[model samples]
Target: MEKITNFSVRIVQKYLPSAFVLAVILTAIIFVLGITIADQGPMTMAGYWGDGFSKLFKFGMQMVLVLLTGYVLAMTPIIKNALNALAKQANTPKQALAITIVVSFICYYLNWGFGMVAGAILARAMGSSVKVHFPLLVAAAYGGELVRGPSSSIPLIIATPGHFMEDAIGIVPVSQTLYSSWNIALTIGLLVLLVAFFLLQKQPKDIIVLEEKEEIIETKVFEGKMCFSDWIEHSRIPTLFLGLLAASYIINKIISDTFSLNLNTMILIFLALGLLLHKNSASYLNAAELAVKAARGIIVQFPLYAGIAGMMTNAGLVTIFSNAIISVATIKTFPLLTFLCAGIVNFFIPSGGGQWAIQGPIMMEAAYNLGADPALTIMAFTWGDGWTNQIQPFWALPLLSVAGLSARDIMGYLVIWLGISGIAIAGTFIILM
Candidate 1:
């Protein structure tokens, strides 16, 4: 039994790196096809690949800024002192877990990058006393942070076919009518699951051991001590980040107003700010390096998926997939089916926008044919997309790596959390549908 258990663990561990590699290879294949065969000319393929690569690099660099900010904040004596104070107050795992969940949710909604930094900071602070695994805390942070996506926000107005249903059928879909209510239900469900997990888990005594060990060996050392003003200047780029974020929004607004271009302003802003931040020649060069570093994986993989999406569309595989759902879907069960399909696609296409680009139209057409509420269909898509992040570690990779862990290290904990979220989301959709 012991041998078998160890073998299983080893197999799982071995599979992780292979999975990432396979994804990359598949992406390369797609790039080749897009270049060689797709109706889009060689130049178009090159442009698309280049654009994807550029986006990836920009995102990667922004990730670096986030990492730097987190490191600076974590090294602060004030933050350290506060953690020490908080450590004294945490009497139980429940308190620590509650704090973790709340902070995770808040930061995640504010922005995923900032949310990740917040999670690490909070984990380090609370890890002083809670004695829980750092990865587990980080996983919990990811669980909370991924709940809100494009489907839940105003973007859903354009992405989902809810409005069309109201016009055609003269009835509002459950998602359109009860979006907030469903969201609240899902949020509460996730919170309860997190609290329950923390309460039931064994507390780590290692935290106390680690702290004591550090205290004994450490000489009092202060490095880069700075006043509030200096600290503000150092970490002040969040303001710039925000400004870039706003500028992207304004640019999109201008584009929308003039050319009627509908682009993800948030992503555009993140890319632009990442490019503009380093004004100097050296820093500009560094930005290019950073972009390459950050975006290489994404750049490689996106074209492959884009190829897959193209193939799926061209060969009518998407129709077959949608038809499978349509065959079983009734008004009552349509929402559940929609959720399941969205969840499955999310495994391949992790980006909310990307998934929507592929699945949105098909779902809309199905909803219309089935006499189901389009809004409900959209809600189902959102629920599936957001709920699976607890298990789908792709998005959480950057966050986990930053926290000195890997997806495999935290997969078990996140799976448990994802199970909870999945159940909650599925149940809520059922009830509302």
Candidate 2:
């Protein structure tokens, strides 16, 4: 395992392009596939691409806010102190690996974006405090994100009212999917297996030590007289009051809408809570600036993925691909086949909600025809989407940005976990089916 892992790491480090370039490459590949397989004309393909580019504008903003707010929240003194305290529990590299896996699992299991951001931050903190394999640590943190959390995009979107499939599926509740006995068991088993994998992997020498960088310090001193604008920027009162207002709105939403953490609500709560936790507006903005820097990749790359999704959907390629897979599926084999197809489609349309939009209808048609459980089929797609994310650079952008490493540095390690996670997830699908 160690030798193979080393070989894969060297191969990826030598060959993988920058994630942005990879996104471009994916765009080009999808275009060719659209023309050849879907028989799309050049003008039509251009239209699809153009339409696709802007399709994710709203979702892109939500994701960026998730990354930004999560980062700002992590930078607060309280969160930082808690992370540092967690770091102290790890006296050795192996223990540090365990800590990364557990903390990331708990965070992601609570909320996917929180887990992604918090896991990366926790890895950095652990790296600063202990001698550990940095790439493996980051990879392990990402590995914890493979299970679908309740707040995950696709399931939550499906559960919400007026989703694309609302008329077809009639709002399949979380109890039938996210909180299902099958999903709960599978998640627990995945966590346990991943923890064991990290503990048992041979430690590599030549681990990189994280470099310390100077942070923007927040200042409260006014030069002379405090102006109204200066007070708004530097004082706690106005910011705190606004934060309270935001919090009150979120509280009302929870009470009225039930205790669900959908994307919009999660972003709102995180933004408000981040503002509330900071000492003053300056401090919050300073942390926010850092967060923006870390999330630069996400800010730029999401539109490209969105465009890819647009092409996949508008070009009629999603149905072609999904139907090709559905053609071979029996009732007994439908779940696995759909899972495999979803994993393949995820490479092109990387966003969970986006993939569901394109593939959900096709998968539902096949499930209905084959007389399979719609819930199980949906979970299959869920696992596939989460499964390939280990190597997919899209979701890794924010985590990689936070750790200050390129995808090549961690993806090779993640490829190993991808195989492990695939088996566990696939096995569960078989059992449940």
Candidate 3:
């Protein structure tokens, strides 16, 4: 096991390009695929690529905030202290990996943004205190995303009213999808597989722990008499007021029973909690400054991915791909095949909402014709979208940034879990759904 893992890590580290380079490479490859498969002209692909940049611009910024807000929330003094306490629990490498996976999976099961940032930061905390293979540890942090299939995002999309496909399939409520027996079973089943599989991977001898940095609290010390401006800088009143404003709306959301724990609401919650926990403007802004550093990777790389999505959709590649895969599906095979199709498409279009916009309609329509259950189909598509994320670099940006590792540093370990999860998710859909 150790030899195989070492070989995989060595090969990926030697050959895998940086995430940005991989995005550009994916762009070029997609451009060519557009020409060959979709028979799109170069100008057409370029047009799609350019236009598609705007498609994900808003979503990209949302991701940036996801990293920023999540980071800011994680950096608060209370959270930092909590992480330090948690870090002390793991004395061995195996224990470190196990705890990281459990923590990450739970966070991911709650909100992708929280899971993505907190998991990575926690891994860093663990690496600092425990003698573990840092890459494998980070990979375990990321592996928690496996639970997103049922907890949020893709499933939430189809369940919401006014979704792109709602007019056709009607609104598939959360009770039918997220809260279903099959989905609950699959989620639990996959998590067990993820934990066991992650723990089994061999740890490396050459461990890379995080470099110690200065304390996060940054106060402007004025030895002389303090001025009014300096007084405001240290004031907690601003944060108190800000927290109250955000908290009021959240209160209304829960009071009305409208809070779905969706990504948007989760971000708001993070913002409110971050502000309240920081207690003062100085600590809040200090955390914000460092949060930007962690968010930089997400800011630059997402547009490239958006353009890739544009190319795939514009060139009709997503359509072509989805149709080809689902065309041959039977009732039992439809769910599994749709999952298979989604996993393949996710490499090019990593965004769950983006893929669902194009492929969701196709698969949902195909499900109706084949007599496959709509909710089951949704779960299958969700699994496929997340399944390939094991090796996909786009979604890993935020986690990798906070963990201070490159994509190659972790992808090798994830590649193995990708297969394990593939079989588990695929088998669940086939046997049960």
Candidate 4:
């Protein structure tokens, strides 16, 4: 295990390009696939890719805020102190890996956006206190998100009243899917196994000591010489008022929307927390400015991903891939095949909701035609969505941004877990379905 882990780590560290370059390579590959498999004309494919490149601009901005807000909130003195306190719980590399996975799992199970940011921040905190392998820690943090349930986009969408295939699937109340006995059992077992797996892989000789950088807090020097601009920047009253305002909305969302902790809500919470924690607007802005640097990859790389998604989606490549898998599937093998297909499609369509929108109908139709359980089929898709996320740079953007690392730095370590967990999920479906 140690030899394999070291070999994987070394290979990734040596061969993986920077995240931006990887995005470009993916774009070119997808373009070639579009022309060949998708039967798209060269000019037409470029047009689709061009249009698609700008499609995620808004989503990218939201993600930028997600990382920036989360970073700023983590930088707050109170939050930093709390994280440091948590870090002290892990004395050794193995303990740190275990704790990081458990914490990241819970956070992501609640909301993936929250999990993405929280896991990265927590890993960094844990790394500061223990001589843990930073790349593996980040990978474990990401790997923890594989436990899909009601919090996941596809499950929640299917559980909702008016999803696209409402007549076919008919509002699966998570009990039959996410909250099912098998799912719950698998989730718990997976968590235990992951903790043990990470522990065994932790070698004393391989521990990487990461230096936690000191945060520079800016403060107003003189109150006597304060002009209106300085006063506005230094005043706590305005920021406090805005924080209270944001808090009110968040509380309203929880009360009125019934425990709504979606990505938007998570962002708002981070924003409010940052405002409340910092002394004034200027301090908060300064922290935010520093955090923004972390999201540079998102700003540059997401459009390229969006473009690739466009080529795959617009040219019917996703459907071709799904059909290819379906062609080889029997009733017994349908769920497992669907899972494998979803895992493959995830490389193109990284967004859960988006993947479901495209592949859900096709999978559901096959499920009904073949007399397979609808709930089990969708769960297979859910597992597939998570299975490939380990190596998919798209999902890693925010976490990578926070960790100051690239996808290659951690993907080699994570790919091993992807195989391990994929087998677990696939086996569960084959036995239970």
Candidate 5:
């Protein structure tokens, strides 16, 4: 076990440099382009970076909500106890993996933020007995992430591409270009992908085996625990939690409402709530600190990505790429093409909203010209944005960092699932087409 732990540590150390280097190079390239070309002006690069920095607090608030949800769920005694029971009931890697996937899926469907929390709580509740097989435990959480789909991707699934098509072109296409049909195909594809992943995962031999050593168990004994009081204290914050959840829903709705005024309202509400719930000065300070920590990942990363996207779009990179796609792609191939393009772009632009902002215009145009379903085009984009996340380093960072693991440790494990997801998405598109 000591050897295995050491090996995992080394792998983490090795990967950290690579991840950091990639981030720096990507950021630099984008900034250079924004300044030198793209006609963004001399101050544009600085403005982009500054704007990202300023929004750090808002980003941090989102992160705090994510962490708090996860932390609170983990802290629940019932969940902890349940995990202990499960660990004793099913002792092997296969059993644990199955349980993890089911739990993750349930949690994810509830809400990705909360789902992550629930997964962490369950994993911790299982205790040291389960941690004896750390790799399996980690894999379980990751499995959930893949199965959950992207948060932003969900919106595209329901949005009528027809609306965008009308704006892009004067006349609507005769056939539904890509709405419900594409969704159905993608759903079926994802189901098959999940099955394949399950089958492939049955063989534990493929997993990297660390040198076995003596197990070190850490057990927490709950003796004469104040069950009632604990429950009340924990549940006391539900008003705040529920209020936040509702606000989140409203914020999402307002952002999607097309009236830009709602964006300002949403921001104001977020700030006010942060201040209100913060209580005393010390607590408020703490909230502020937490918010900063939470926002770091998004704030640091988003601008560079946005700039890259801007450059690509301005330079006609997407037009050039999409044209190539159109040259060979037939009307019957619309669904597949949409999926492929969405997936490819997702690698560079990880955010669903961000990707849509850039790719949506071009895609809508294509759908109108080709006599395809606009809704189907949106679904294709959704599939592409989500399917690649399993392999994308950006989204994996938060989860991995929280789990005390690095990308390299899990990257190999995700390879099969990523391929499976891609095929499922692509296949769905083809079927719909």
Candidate 6:
């Protein structure tokens, strides 16, 4: 297995392009496919791409906030000290990998945005001292992002009352989708499998460890006579009041049971905590500027992926692709088939919500025709969106940036996880769903 992993790593390092290159290649492929296979005119395809390019702007902003807030929160003095303290617990490489995976599992299961950066920070903390396989530790941390957990986008959207698909599928409650027995079992099972797969990877005699740890610096005092403007800039009043204000809103929502873990809500949760942690505007903004850099690729690439989704939608490529596989599914096999369709489409449109936007209608209609459970189909789609992330570099960029690693450095290992977990997911859909 170690030999296999090393061989896979060598292959990926040799041939795999960066995430940006992958996006451009996907865009060109989608364009050509739109014209040839989808039977759309080139001009029509271009217009579809243009019109649909910005459709994801709202979701894109939410994603950026997730990265931004997560980063800023981690940079706070209290958070940094806590992470450093926690780093002391994992004294060995194996312990570091295991503990990072467990921490990531809990964080990611609770909130994806929080999990995205939390794992990297924890891994970095552990790597600062432990002679661990740094890339492997980071990969283990990132591997826990099932994307189908509490912060899942598609499930929450479909469960919402005013969603676009409501007329067709009705407002399916979270109990039927996210909180269902099968989904719970599937999530737990996948996490266990990831832990097993990642931990079992053979460690090297000379493991990659961080040569230099990122120093957490104290915010220094102003050198000159502090002016009124300087006082305002560093004032803790705004952070206290505004952070508390955001906290109050979240508290009310939680108490009232009205809070759903959608993108905006997740951002607020992170923001409230981040502002409180950073203590003042200057500190928060400085950390924010650092966080914003992690999200730069997300800002650039989301539009390209959105354009791909637009072309797929307008050119009827979504229907074409979905119906092609869905055509063969029997009533008993519908859930498994939907999972497969979602996994395939996940390659082009990496976001679960975005994938659903294009492929949901087709699958939902087929579910009705085949008499399959809509909730099961939804969860299946969610897991499919998640399963491919093992090899998908889109979500890994921020985590990689934080860990100071590249996609090629870890994808070889992730590719192996992709195959292992995919089978487990497919089996669950087949046997249980």
TM-score of each: 0.64, 0.95, 0.94, 0.87, 0.65, 0.95
Model 1: lDDT to the true structure: 0.56
When summed lDDT is taken over every stretch of 10 residues in candidate 1, the lowest stretch is 209-218
lDDT of each: 0.56, 0.83, 0.81, 0.79, 0.54, 0.84
Instruction: Kindly list the per-residue Cα lDDT of model 2 for residues 1-433, writing each as its tens digit.
Output: 7777888888999999998999999999888888998889878887898888888788778777877887788777887788779999999989998988998898888776678778988898899889887888888898887778866788788788878798888788878989998799889999999998777777777877666553544676767799888877787886699889989987887779665657887777888888888989889888888788777887788888888888888888888888888888899888998888989899877778878877888899889888999888888998898889888888888788778788998888888888888988888777777
On a 0 to 100 scale, what is the lDDT of residue 270 in model 5? 41
Which parts of model 2 are misplaced by more than 4 Å? 214-217, 223-225, 256-259
TM-score of 6: 0.95
Tens-digit lDDT track of model 5 for 201-274: 43333444323331122222346765865444334354456446756766686788742222233334444354
Regions more than 4 Å wrong, model 5: 1-18, 28-89, 124-127, 131-133, 146-295
Alpha-carbon runs more than 4 Å astray in model 6: 213-220
Model 1: residues with Cα > 4 Å off, grouped in runs: 1-15, 22-94, 128-130, 149-179, 203-304
Q: lDDT at 216 for candidate 2?
A: 49
How many Å off is the CA of 97 in candidate 4?
2.2
The TM-score-based order of candidates, best leading, equals: 6, 2, 3, 4, 5, 1
Error of 6 at 259 (Å): 3.2
Error of 3 at 246 (Å): 1.5
| lDDT (tens digit, per residue) of candidate 3 on 250-287 | 99989998876555666778889998998689888988
lDDT over C-alpha atoms for residue 284 of model 6: 89
**C-alpha RMSD by candidate, in order:** 8.6, 1.8, 1.9, 3.0, 8.5, 1.8
Model 2 reaches what TM-score against the true structure?
0.95
Rank list by lDDT = 6, 2, 3, 4, 1, 5
